[model samples]
Target: MTSTPSLPDPAGAGQPIVLPANGTTVAAEDLQARFVHAADANADMTIDASQVENVGQAMLQLLVAARAHAQAEGLHFAINAPSEAFLARVAACRLGEPLGLEMEKEREQ
Candidate 1:
């Protein structure tokens, strides 16, 4: 199943921004738009990365930017239910710290 980004609403305030299984450049636009929508609404951003199997640099960069944007806006940004592949790709790119991925473990506790 292809993941689609969801806009935050009162009824879905904590809904996550779901990432497509193939996190390549093709999905970057949709991802960015999702981030923009969340930022525009001054909402906290949560990413659902469980579907991500193969993520490319473009998608990774967008994620980093999204985190920075959320931080600058004083909003929380987190990834939930990340898949092993997603974690490994972020680690392979040495972006675990930047993406606040290690914090996921902390949050689970």
Candidate 2:
């Protein structure tokens, strides 16, 4: 069975971009594009990664860059309900801080 990927809604502030289940390098470009579009449209953004089953360094880098860009623009960027796989990859890559993820809570979740 095939599942449709959840696409981000580029509308108002605090809009959430739900990450795909496979968060590897293959999805980095698309994810980056969506993240940019959402962040630009909204002053505050939430990225829901609860379905992520895999993660790659490239994806992590994109997220870090997006967070940095948002901060520079004085916008709020938050990762909501990150999956265990996503959290593990972030911890392995030491990108928790750059991505503004609360590691302790992430582990607990």
Candidate 3:
């Protein structure tokens, strides 16, 4: 049987959640859990996507939802140090605004 994707532990207050290099559908559940944990902490959360090499729509949706949840709960949510691949996929999927990611071209600068 294939092993489930492992997610990193939640960081402490004001820390960033470093996303897995492959942020695809395979890790959707894990990603969701992480986001929930961070959001429920009622503190600022920074999602680091510097290592994301592969991503899918599910992951994008989760990020969007997490961002909204954080907003509703009065928590700060931000995406930091996004990888080129990650930005490209966000742009391709038109999730930049929802995911709070800068456009690929803009982020490349």
Candidate 4:
């Protein structure tokens, strides 16, 4: 008897992130490290949420913090490739507009 794994509902609970093959993964550890690097280098960073899943509340906080850090340094911050599921989370949490996530990037632009 084999049990199948369940796909977590985006609204059900928080899930850990799966880093993408390219681009920086915005998981907890990376979020912290990136924040420091940006602070030291005074550069803005983008988070690609399209290939990301299993997002938890902590991850969201990290993004918020990153934006704040960038703003403090007068840097430009942006989010690209946010999946619908992830976008829903931001809307549900009322953070989409504040985060400046216009919407997910369209393919074949």
Output the number of the lDDT-best candidate.
Answer: 1
Clashes of 2: 0
Tens-digit lDDT string for candidate 3 (13-87): 556877888877878887677777776556577888899999887888888898898888887789998888998
TM-score comparison, 3 vs 4, better candidate: 3
The local distance difference test score of each candidate is 0.82, 0.78, 0.78, 0.61
Worst 10 residues of 3 by lDDT: 6-15
lDDT of 4 by residue, 1-109 (tens): 9999964332123222333432333456655665566556666566667865456666777778877877878987777777766776777776775677764432112
Clashes of each: 0, 0, 0, 1
RMSD of each: 7.7, 7.4, 6.7, 13.5
- Quote each prediction's TM-score: 0.80, 0.77, 0.78, 0.64
Model 1 lDDT tens row, 1-109: 9999954472146778888999989899867777777778888888899999999999999999989988888988898899988987887777887888884543333
What candidate 2 gets wrong by more than 4 Å, as runs, is: 1-14, 39-42, 105-109
Off by over 4 Å in 4: 1-26, 103-109
TM-score, candidate 4, is 0.64
- Tens digits of per-residue lDDT for model 2 on 1-108? 999995556523355777888877878987777777776675566788899999877888888888888898888788999988888888777778899987875454
Candidate 1, residue 37: the lDDT equals 74
Error of 4 at 23 (Å): 15
